[model samples]
Target chain A: MYLRGYVSSREFFEYNPPQKIQNLAIRDYCSSNKFNYLLSATEYSMKNSYLILDEFLKFRDGSDGLAFYSIFQLPLNFTLRQNIFDKILKKRKQLHFSLENLALKNKNDINLIHNLFFIKQSYQKCLSLTDIKQNLKL
Target chain B: MLNSTVLSKNFLSDGYLKIRPKNQKYLFEIQKIITNKISKTKLSKKNQISFLNNFHKFQNPSNLNDTRLKIYNYINSKSIFSKMYYEIVKEYLDILVGNELVMQNKINLSIQLPNDKSSILPMHSDTWSGDSPFEIVVWIPLVNCFKTKSMFILNPKESKHFYINYKKNSKKHDSKSLFNLYKSKFKWIDIKFGEVLIFNQCLPHGNVENITSETRWSLNCRFKSLFSPYGTKKIGEFFKPINIKPASVIGFNYNDPLAE
Candidate 1:
């Protein structure tokens, strides 16, 4: 539904999607085991459904979600997505958990909320996902 | 992940993208032309700072001096520049800011002398204002940068620590010592005269002193996202980065060409 306006993945099925991105996104979904949206995202035609796929995937979970921003914004790639996703998931969790509970914060708790604080003061210096994985040896 | 079309996803994953473009001659020529311009000048420490401040004042809004921003008009007329260079750079720009990205600035070159190298830029990320994350930084080192010369660091992995490790939480010490740390960690660029080093300016990057016998001449032209603010005029007309965004113009003036 999110990609309805933008051409979904189905449109490009019969023919080669126009942009270099289409081939990549389509192939990416084909390779992954959990790409249910890929069929929906690509409308078997050139529909620019990837943008909505990106928005939808962000709300979704696991690597498929990470793959959206990574593949589409290759230069941005997936590295920055860790922070972006962790924040999204943490917020989602909070919303769900708040219906039942809440969690405490600490110095060691520098995952999503912790990274969130650093967003304002020194956002420019914000590291991409690759840098963190490299530095922390993740 | 193993797509045939993917020509090394490493570049995308790494924030500091290092590409050896097929055509490098234009960069070399641009450096030579800039070197000639430098040789003709006295190149004083004060002059370097004044030039930086002048460029800054022309675009910065806090001051009343948004006048005479003529660097753009000057570069547009340069005989040494080729249309191809513009095309390639513009293509790269589109990659950074999308196909619709506009020219935020023309081009501004700086020859950082030993004396004034320590001032002005204080390890701030290119995103000090509202720089597009997708935007690309085309660093044309007009001068040779090496270990002894003005080289830099990519921090591909540790780069994410930029906001956290260095800015938000890093301890402060003497300015000289901190710069020394920056120098020590820096990977001196063994670049030829024309090689363009493309990186996300969001990555912590800067140059050391021009320890070499020659000077470190460089043109740092910052571009903005397509829909990003450009105040009232076209940014390319300024030839300098619109730091802090217009309205808070960080030293761009169009009415007065020599206001600087």
Candidate 2:
């Protein structure tokens, strides 16, 4: 299958790996899975920027899928991420996350990805309240 | 007093600093907390140094990990311990790193028993194992550590050469043999109880078997600028914001007016 790589210039997952590093990881992932690799389109390093990704979705080429370096590289806004997923499903194109080694081929896969985002959001919420020391005298 | 510009330049080149803390009370408190928890019998201030130095006698050498984990968990559970840890090195970190910083969630405790082969840290850089190159390690000792009781680090100049040519070096030698080859170049840090050592984690550093009579007790934790580039060890998991400036706080919470 032919897969175009998607990488982000914006820092996510608390750290941003270099675009070169991200691209390399995607290339290796495609090679291991025996998929045809296409040059990556990097999202701009600005808040809520998914312009490149939106453009990638509009392409009507024979590419079978879009591979992301990580699922966290997707837009932080749930609606934006859902819209991307919806676009992928509408196009009948597969979505792959290299770091997570996950695939979104159907509604079930989309649900799994949604669950992961929920889990991460829940974790971040719990962490914000964990610093009990803030109330301590010391 | 040495200016920050000189200190930063020296730190850039040397990659490490051994200096005394501005206040000894916090350091004493930290030592007291660990000692009180570990020692079955209460120790007076006079005996605390001896107690820590000869800890192997009181502690079961075979069950070292159990004692280590207990103290590690105990100290980390107390927010004051971490607060004091940061306070001890706050000045240096502010100058070398920045005022706005993120600290490692859990500080690491090292208990090296005399000649214990199991606990030795092999020669390596934290950056090689997914730690951010921007992070710096603040290492503090509980007793006078010298010779084999302390850790060794390669200077940045030599480390640069070593890392650049690591591909050829790895094929020729393993970690042990690589250590032996560069053995003479390694600086065995001889640090005292009241002093704190801050070093660049990108430099190759580790400890050998503690051949000294005294057991070595040291604590190390990492700190980096809040906005610095990170490796695989991401924030909220490996690190948490210790201090944030007002502008940054406003910036983080700021909603762009132009956004729909």
Worst 10 residues of 2 chain A by lDDT: A123-132
Chain A, candidate 2, TM-score of 0.88
lDDT of 1 by residue, B1-260 (tens): 22322322544555544455556666554544433442446455335424432333233333212122333334545634634455545545445454443443345555444434442354445655545454566666655556544546556565665455665345675555655655555555676544666667666666554444444555655555533433323222222221233432222122346643
Q: What is the TM-score of chain B alone in each candidate?
A: 0.59, 0.97
Evaluated on CA atoms against the true complex, candidate 2 attains a DockQ of 0.03
> Model 1 over residues A6-87: C-alpha lDDT tens digits?
2334322122334345445434443432333333333233333335445544546333222221112211222343454455
True-contact fraction per candidate equals: 0.00, 0.00
Tens-digit lDDT track for model 2 on B38-145?
Answer: 787888876888999988887888899999998997998797899999998888888999998888878999999998999999999999999978799999998999
Cα lDDT computed for each candidate against the true fold: 0.42, 0.84
Each prediction's DockQ against the real complex: 0.01, 0.03
Number of the top-ranking candidate, with lDDT as the measure: 2
Provide the TM-score for each candidate, comma-separated: 0.43, 0.67
Output the number of the DockQ-best candidate. 2
Where model 1 places Cα greater than 4 Å from the true spot, the runs are A1-138, B1-8, B32-73, B76-84, B90-97, B114-122, B166-184, B228-260
Error of 1 at B215 (Å): 1.0
lDDT of 2 at B230: 60
